[model samples]
Target: MAYDVQSAKTWSPGDNAFYLIVEGTTQEEIKEYWEQLITDGEILQPLAPSQWSPLYGMLKHQFGVVWALSVLNDASPM
Candidate 1:
């Protein structure tokens, strides 16, 4: 099977380099997962969260990809 390029966005210094963002159930688990990804060299740099209301983090992956993972509340999807 072959896939066609849908859309490609240019990268800028201000733009995060994340390609994949995986959401976890809890903030703690998300942090742990982020650390694990770093340990495995999946992410290069993890950004500092500017706000506490939303649990967010940024990391540069080994593949030169950047990712942002967020832990949403259980009722968020609903």
Candidate 2:
């Protein structure tokens, strides 16, 4: 599957923070993307594949933005 940064926005101190959610079909694919993000960015939360679910993780982009990445399998709730 292909992915892209859909859009971006800025905020103030009191305003809500922004989070980009990336969904992928498989854990390997998402993990590869996560590694790329790590090479150029910083890891907020190390990649964790849930025992009860598929996968979930967080990272801070090089552009000073936060992103939540995940891989959803057929058994995933969302």
Candidate 3:
């Protein structure tokens, strides 16, 4: 599927408020993504177990877009 592209003023890295959410089925998968991000992008936060509810972590994409990745395990109440 194709989507429309909008033209706007370019923003500096970590300047925009928009972010992305990437969901996975396991912590390993999330870790893999984190590793890839570290190699290609930047790590906003290290890949560690979340202190709150379900297991999750946040990182910045290669294009400066923030990504909140999570593992939706069955053990999670949510």
Which candidate comes out best when scored by TM-score? 2
TM-score of 2: 0.66
Ranking by lDDT: 2, 3, 1
Per-residue error (Å), model 3, residue 52 = 4.3
Off by over 4 Å in 3: 1-14, 52-54, 75-78
Runs in model 1 with CA error above 4 Å? 1-18, 40-53
- TM-scores for candidates 1 onward, in order: 0.53, 0.66, 0.60
Model 2 poorest 10 in a row by lDDT: 1-10
lDDT score, residue 47, model 3?
A: 64
How many clashing pairs in candidate 2? 0
Cα lDDT of model 1 by residue, 1-78, tens digit: 112222575555444433566666777878887877675454433434434324667566565556667776645552
- In terms of lDDT, the poorest run of 10 residues in model 1 is 1-10
Backbone clash count, each prediction separately:
9, 0, 0
Query: CA RMSD for every model?
Result: 6.8, 6.4, 6.8
lDDT of 3 by residue, 3-31 (tens): 12224745554454566666678777878
